[model samples]
Target: MENANRGYERLFGDDGLTVGATFPLTSARTTRPNVGRELALTERLEALGFDGLWARDVPTDWPKFDDTGQTFDPWTWLSRVAARTDDVALGTASVVLTLRHPLHVAKQAASLDHLSEGRLVLGVASGDRPPEYEAFGVAEDERGAAFRESVEVLRAAWRDAHPEVETRWGTLDGTLDVVPKPTAGDLPLLVTGNSRQSREWIAAHGDGWLFYHLPEDALRSYLDDWNERTAAPFVTTCTVDLAGDPEADPEHVNQGFRAGAAWFRDYFRELDAWGVDHVIVGVRGDDRERAYERVAERVLDRL
Candidate 1:
């Protein structure tokens, strides 16, 4: 396994606009997955020169959310990926921070960072899973505060040898400690969707941002406003179902688009011009292998 903190450099280099692929290679709705195939594709993605490999955290099955991200435990799955790949950044697209204890989150995140040789970018959120609140016994109103506390605790836990923090997740006295600190001694805590916190709060506390796909015009305006407020990198996601015809124009899909590789290059170029730092794409096709084929010569080769 590699043993260096290159995750940050790999994602945010002097050059701009890196690309990554999201988990669940196939859009299979069921919770079960063909782990062997997913791993194979992950290795392929790395070999193909994608900058990162993003995994999702879905602690429980919540159909309303519409997607079962990878259908595997984020920690275990990412650890396996880290061991398999040589140097692709390992990330959690958005871990529901409020639902789990911050200590446990810190421990797992730190461990993954080490195993990946400091290639962990933790994307976190207060959680949008409504039923999970009741299941985890976390009150809805308390989630925002809980989210803030979790971020603070995670940062402290990874850095301070014996951090003293008190929150709804429980108190961490200076006497106690969590082991296996991050390989870099820090994890880029990128907050997703504000988590019901103010933009000011997000800018102040978060190391970066992970937002949903927005209209190009709105995105430009939003980025300008955000840039004026903070220097954080603006990150987003796209679901791509590349058309067989490389010259086809883009048509709207859910939070993304269905287009040809030619359109994809221009689309991504537009994002780069608009100041987008990185994009995590969820490939959509007839199957996982077909999706890779569509992206290979058509997309990656051109880019």
Candidate 2:
């Protein structure tokens, strides 16, 4: 695959840095179902000048995780969003690669990439939910291995013709060649968190990194560490509760920064300064329309 044809390079840049937000399609369920609001919201986001819309992959409910974000199938939601918007990029905050077959992921992602005209950014991680892993008949400790294997398989399937893949999970002996190759030749793949993999491997293989909210200093340190090891860019996702008042005080969510428009603007500037290439803002606990409007009016213009 040509380097210029990589989705990450096109969506972000050579630096791999862009600013984006998580759409409230799933979280703001009171208004309508995801499919109903997807197109309009996507168009709104693109019109508002946002770069991308990130979706989450939640196969099952986990009350203990206290995950307030909507649990939707990332691929399906992205496909719907892709059909709706013409420019804004589509992504998964992460799809738990350990639980699913890599070939399945490669095929679906390639199809989505082609359908979306090469606007797919894939974030993958080793699943942490013990119960979910157990249900899938995969041991907890095996997640790391599974994650590595999945990455290898997906890359091979996408780049190699009739590639042979073998691992404990499964094996493929040149019997299949996934169809609908990515429009960009390769889909951008970001590694979310450490996922039990070493920084060296992640830096070497991943196109980017997906991380959560951390203190400025901590985030800077992490970015420095990642940069030291690899030139690949980094991507971070955060839950944001945009306040109506431009001067509203900042609050906190699990991995979000709760602040008014003014603060949000400054925060993004800081992130940009810190060398964060792209930020996927997860919208939670806000008046959906008003919050998005505020961001569009105040923050998007400035970014």
User: What TM-score would every model get versus the actual structure?
Assistant: 0.94, 0.90
Candidate 1 local distance difference test against the native: 0.83
Mind giving the per-residue lDDT tens digits that candidate 1 earns over 1-303? Answer: 122367767887646788888888755465777888888888888887888888888888877777787889999999999999987888898899989888999999888888888889888998888898999899998999999989889978988999998877788889999988888777888889879999889888877788988888888887887788787778898888888788999999988999989999888888888888889887765577668666766776676
In terms of TM-score, which candidate is strongest?
Answer: 1
Residues 205-284, model 2: lDDT tens digits: 88888887788789999999987887677788776777767788888767776778899888878887788888877566
Alpha carbon lDDT of each predicted model: 0.83, 0.76
Candidate 1: list runs displaced more than 4 Å. 1-4
Provide the clashing-pair count of each candidate structure.
Answer: 0, 3
Best by lDDT: 1
